[model samples]
Target: NVAVILAGGVGSRAGFSRPKQLVKLGGLPVVAHTIKRFQSHPLIDEICIVSTADHLEEIERLASSLKAHKVKKVLGGGTERRDSSLAAIAAYEHEALSGPLYLIFHDAVRPLVSDEVIDRVINALRHYNAVDVAIPCADTVVSIDQVTNEIISIPDRRSLRLGQTPQAFLHDTISTAYAAALRDPPRAHTDDCGVVLHYLPSEKICVVEGDTYNHKLTYPTDLLILEKFLQSNGGRRKVADTGDRQLTQLRGKSIAIFGGTSGIGEKMAELGERFGAKVSIGSRRNGVDISHAPSVQEFLKEVVATHGKLDAVVNSAAVLTYQPLEALSDEDIVSSVGTNYLGALHVARAAYPYLRESRGHLLFFASSSYTFGRAHYSVYTSSKAAIVNLTQALADEWDGADVKVNCVNPDRTATPMRTRAFGHEPQDQLLDAQTVALDALSVLVGETTGCIFDVERR
Candidate 1:
């Protein structure tokens, strides 16, 4: 798959002396940030930048810095937006990319576009020949006549949607559609979806739900909002801990600690407090059962109600049951899965609203058992594996919400549960609770979400 980033816009709407795409955003060019999203995406194999001849060298300089993908070509765009699309298609053909290649066209101004959005568009290409990204209109859309500036026929507001990029398609299909559309006078459309719809009316362009946070940089005020977003996330990215405990990244932040009553969880709460976080606990001992959705919901609600702000939620609640699969009772199985897997869901579902409001972090704990399927603990390991997948899935689902999701997989920890399960692993061979707690907090502060961070083994 390849991404074609269009930077040919004249920046007429933006009063800046230079082009809007070239404008510095969070210490990088707006286009650089836009390029980074695709460059870092695992699926993207190559990139093509389309711009005016004057800006090609500068964009090449910036693209060189991001060695994430092979920049196959940097070509000059046509006078119109459609012209750039043509140039990209021609270059793609010149490269002789294999039959039915996938192409994603994104605007350089929309720097915050997430990998989830790009992935969804590419996934949709499997079934749909052409696809577009759009979000439901929050405000009622009105139709007005431009001639007299009078109210015209009002379409159903419920059906209206605001479109965004990157609009994607099968390289051959969209290029064919564009080839047919270019025969007539240039059509005034903002996106390729219109080009396909107008020329290839028979083909249906699938619409994927896009994120609100993926706002394009058009107006001057948008620069201020993006700048603030950068600062909040800690300078162009999240605050990743570099084993520097003295930094105290969580200072003044409020965090909810599920399963915070004993062992590792208790130590985590204590460390959070020590690191300057206002920590709240959710555990069975505190009248909050993670397996029960309602209890988890109310626990977080109360935490936010008391603290007045919630920055993160760490769900370290899991039962380490050491029993063969056949030997485990039905009730025991249900309890383990519910607490280990569904418990994470309960916290995520319950905390989404508040987390999204604050753009907070959601951290779930997985055990070392997840990687090496320990025979006696089949159910426990399986549930922990599910937690890892859930963390990634939820991260993608909530990309627009900006609520980061991650899983921390720790080795055998010196906790009551470890002693209860395996009697006694030597103290030297067991990871101390404090070490695991700090590593988990590192995940919370880091900008890299949707990861399975493994704590160092003793």
Candidate 2:
């Protein structure tokens, strides 16, 4: 499949000197980031960025600056979006694109778009001839007259969808649709899917649930929110260590161990390495700033690039609480949730591509206290409970994807965090961290998800 990026529009709303797509989100140009994602996709065969004739020089410079090598051609866009799309179609035909070509059209302004979404669009296009990525309207939608303030129609919000790019199509189907549009053009629409809907039947148009995080950058104020998002979700390139050893049993497979440098995570890495699977480890000590979403995102991309495939993931990293609720600051809660709950979510999202590719297993480290309800461990327990709930929800949602999601609830593991929570206790009641690690690994090694393994040596 070949991907085409629409970078023609001058985003006047963003108030930049040029198009908003060229604006920087983090360090790279927003369009550059979008292009890199498709470039990184294993299934995508080629990439072409369609920009304005005036912007072609700048876009070429931007691509070179970002080291975007997968982009085979950089062409000029048309007067309108339809024209811009036709320009891309012409470019594909010029190349004599052979075989069953799948075409994906993306908005360059949406920098946060994930590889998972791109894969979904590709998978959809393979089976169905045409599809669009969209989010169902969340708020009550009303259509009002431009002349009068009165409501013209109360549209069913459930049926209404906020269209987004990368809208995908069979190359021939879209080419046909565009050619037909040129004969008797309809009113201008933002997406090619809208153009197709005019000429094609309703059954031909399909909508895939779009991630709300895949937002388009349109305003200056959005930068701050995006920055915060980048920070919390893990940045542009965060590294994960996939323990891949040639002599290991699962040598060809890939497994991820969160906080693998220490505690149960370290033990899991050892086992995974011995099992012959590539293990991806996330550690704060390794310069991974999960507090920043962009950093986390970057780390995940690094892990995927390193392993080339991901077969399993076990989040053995977590924070323990010591302060009372009254004494705890917002910083404390942020640190705990950022590492224990949200950090896991970020890793999961980042590792999604590998899991989808491998149809692998996902394991979370929860706590018995989360379910048993212990005192003075409010924040820690709360975070674990969130993981448990998330594991359940993700498992339910991943029914179509064939990936397994589950968690391990350990009662008391003697790790550094446990020492911080209990203060140098020489108690035999605590279970060995390695023991918990093996139990979690067993669940992943097998095929089980949405189940929490309670490990308490009582």
Candidate 3:
């Protein structure tokens, strides 16, 4: 199976100086994320990108940086969307003669296309010649007369669906449809599925279910919406279960842990050492205040000087004060934000150079409350939310440089910080700090990046 990414649009409607596909989302270009979806999927055997002539070189560079080894070709596309689709189909024309071949055509702007959506399209193609992905439309559709500014008819919403991408087809089926189109093209044709439906009436095009998050980047505001989606797990969520498994990948790796004096950080330091990692702990109690930028920079510099190369940096440093907004002073707000939010930022920025050189990982900590704000712990919750976003953003930004950035969102853990904020919780209700630390260690040694590993009590 082959995945063809259409990235030829100029994106005038998106209001971007460059094409919308080139716009940065999370850290890599929009098209990079789109390619990554198919690049990482197990079913996809090869990839081909159809891009504008002007951006062809840049797109090739991105594919190389992503190590998209599956990409077979990067061809120049015509002006229209169908033209790009045709280019992709034509590229595989000769290859189709060898045997049966399948092509999955997807939009480069829809980066959040899930594995489920791709799986459905592939499964449908097994029984059908052509397949399309779409979600049921919620809004009522109106057919309006062009002459008069009046609605002609209202269609039932249940019958309408908003179309999405990864439209799959057998190589011969799509090629035949396009061959007919070139001789007598339809006056108004949008997608390859439309051509197949029109040019070959007997051929049935199957419809597969797409997701709400598989939306195309059409307007400027859509970028912000996509960013929020990316921060919220990027449509891929995983539950970390270390389960007494020892991660030997940490052997000989140099790891730095902030807020390592107690709680999850301390436990992480202990486990890292147990796994043969050269561990270094930093905390305010140890004369290193993460909230202070210079303190973090100096500490990392020392770690590098001692170990020669830093493999992973974990910032579990956080401050949780459960005071209501009305009673909280300026100092209290600053303290919470500085430590929980800014401290993560400081660590990420300071650790980047080292991590990039070593192609290492950077991990941050987030609480379960990051999904929503909690009463009396508003500042703490908000800061954790920021950490989650920062982790995702840096994941994108540092992707090309080979630095992995991720966040660990653990449920209420029996840590000193939690104890200080909320007094005497039930022992069973809180997670063990060691358990959370183990999960963090697993992520640090793993290849997955730009994700939030949820650690919940079983």
Candidate 4:
């Protein structure tokens, strides 16, 4: 398994005098975190980094300083992103790398990539010749006529997906495609995926799930968010993604799902039981109003009393308002905020004692909508954003007690609530609630804390 991390961009748009990849993000160059993610990955054997000519020395020095044994070399990149990727591919040929090699290319700007994202790309190479990573687009995208400044077409939001990296490909296949692409000087594709699609159209590219936190550093605002998140996260050892082992770990353990009557919450309850868990559902069906603190406290107390002990508390409940902010009634605004943000907090605070006693976990739900902060969904997006920050804060606060707090920012999922909001979308297009529930089960048994995962794709 070979990984090539692209860090050669000028990043003039970022308003940084230096290259954005070299810019300090939490006291380390942005590319360092990206390299370390692969270095720490169990499957990755060797790393080859590509950066600008001027920065290659510093990059090499940084890698050496970090005592990275896996880094094969730090080579100078070309004028374009594709050129850099081609450079790496050329080097692989020069080195006489053996046949049936799996190659991965990732943007250094997206420094917060998780092991699961890396694992998915690597794992897919077993069956797929080419693999791409992407999250479902949250916004309705439009294709406009550039010259006329008119809307040319409105594509189905369900079909649109926002692309991300590390894009994995069979080395021999991509090498041939890239060699053919280099023959055409007039053509330039934006990403490696585009390169594959254009030159290797006959090959099918499998799209795996991508993390929302696997964001590229483009603007100053992006840098601020990335820096703050990294600083807050500090450092922790990562847990291996042990598939069905999570089920065995949860067996016979008690868990309370605050919104476990419908949608993701209800499904988690069923999965928990199927995995041999003692599951308790806390929702309106059980007369528990999560928005109210006292009600949450009393209900959790009852849950613990009934179930013996609580191992994990997951809050999957949320409410949203899509109308104009000013037009929204004060009641609707408060209800949205209270239900989405405070409701999770109410559960977290109330369940902390039981979780602390068992050294268990706290899981919360966020939406990809939090990323865009789109208009008309101010209260909804703002509250979800607050939940993300709150997830980290609670993790920090509970660090001493060994309780892990994490958030899964799922893209559009097929649920009763989403159906009411986004009418008539094919159910098959949306993410299944059970998939997210299974992810939540792993988080419960995992070692990491203060992590935010994207549950966007299959």
Per-prediction TM-score to the true structure, in the order listed: 0.56, 0.60, 0.73, 0.56
TM-score, cand. 4 vs. native:
0.56
Count: clashes, candidate 2 = 37
| Regions of model 2 farther than 4 Å from truth | 94-97, 232-262, 273-419, 422-458
* Highest lDDT scorer: 3
lDDT of 4 at 389: 82
Q: For residues 17-52, could you state the per-residue lDDT of candidate 3 as single tens digits?
A: 999999998777999989888987899999999999
Worst 10 residues of 2 by lDDT: 232-241
Best by TM-score: 3
Q: Please list all clashing residue pairs in model 4, or write none if there are none.
A: none
Residue 32 shift from truth in candidate 2, angstroms: 1.6
Model 3 has an lDDT value of 0.89
Model 2: per-residue Cα lDDT over 176-278, one tens digit each: 8878777884677667887788877553877787887678787888776665454222122112223332333466777767689988889888877776677
After TM-score superposition, what is the CA distance of residue 184 in candidate 2 from its true location, in Å?
2.1
Over the stretch 5-38, how does candidate 1's per-residue lDDT look in tens digits?
A: 9999978888888999999986678898787677
lDDT of 4 by residue, 197-271 (tens): 998899999999996778889998999888755733422222223256547778888888888888888888998
The model with the greater lDDT, 3 or 4, is: 3
Candidate 1, poorest ten consecutive residues by summed lDDT: 232-241
